[model samples]
Target: MEKWKKDYLKGILRDYPKMEDYYLERKEKLLFHTKGTHPHSTTETQNKKMLISISLDRQLINLERNQKVIAQCLENATAETKEIIERLYLSDKQKASLDLVADQVFLSKRQVMRLRDHFFEELAEHLGI
Candidate 1:
């Protein structure tokens, strides 16, 4: 993959957890709408709700599709590949370098790099990027 495409996939991985959380919060807010009389007519309020629901549905579909792609890639990954993903991409802590990840996963740095590259390639293909 091109450098920019690789970086883009990495960026998506990095944001995955945050994106999930954000959408969940949004979903909650949508569900918790205040019940009160408003100046707007019933049709106008319903139309507004319908538009918001449509927008949220689109966002949720995209999120779920990406999540399914990621899940499939992870399902096919080796144990060591999972370790590399958890430590390097999925963790909430600061990102680990390839050297640190290799040490933690009991592999040489070069091997870690190779595994990571392979994993990214698979992920990119799954994502249709």
Candidate 2:
């Protein structure tokens, strides 16, 4: 009947998929926690908008730092070296051979051979070589 009761019911329903039984078992405690008591002030709700804004800022900061690292790594690298690292690290080929990567990337075995030189060159440069 009350607005607060409606909001509490809605919140519980939304969380049903994630932890159905646990939520059901703790339904009384959960409801009591959300609908604050007189002295403990269980009725007060935290601002969802503020929490979301804080989380978004965190995600954006992480994104910017990651992009900066990527740019710096590529700044001193040759295009060929970038391709080699892609094959080695990003091609789902931790233990795969160069020939396989070459085939996947549509390059020759000789080109793959050159990739090794490029990989070391960039790696060393990245590590201040």
Candidate 3:
């Protein structure tokens, strides 16, 4: 992968958990409206308006789509792959180095690096990057 693409994928992996919360927050913000802004509008019109707003929200759409793609990729991932991802990207603690992760998982540092690379490749493919 190009350097930029690799960076982008790494960012997505790092922010996966936050993205879920952010998505919900964005959706809620989009759904909220002033009390009397559409006082005369019918229920169907309000629903349609909300649908259009959501469809037009590029950031929200991308976030939601990425979330789904990540979820799908993870669903079929091996246990070791998931462990590597969680320790390296999803942990609440300080980000782990390859050597640290390898020790925790009982693999060599080189093997840990390989697994991480493989997972990134799969994620990139799924994201079409």
Best candidate according to TM-score: 3
Say which prediction, candidate 1 or candidate 2, comes out ahead on TM-score. 1
- Positional deviation of residue 104's Cα in model 2 after best superposition, in angstroms: 1.1
Note the residue pairs that clash in candidate 1.
none
Candidate 1 residue lDDT tens string, 28-127? 6554542233436586776577557747676676777777788888889999998898899889886699889989999999999888889999988887
Give the per-residue Cα lDDT of candidate 3 at 73. 79
Instruction: Compute each candidate's TM-score over C-alphas.
Output: 0.76, 0.35, 0.85
- Residue 11, candidate 1: Cα error in Å is 1.3
Query: Top lDDT: which candidate number?
Result: 3
RMSD of each: 3.6, 18.0, 2.1
- Candidate 3 lDDT over 65-84, as tens digits, reads 88888888787788888898
Query: What's the C-alpha lDDT at position 46 in model 2?
Result: 31
Q: Tell me the TM-score of model 1.
A: 0.76
Candidate 3 regions exceeding 4 Å error are 33-43
Looking at model 3, which ten-residue stretch has the lowest summed lDDT? 29-38
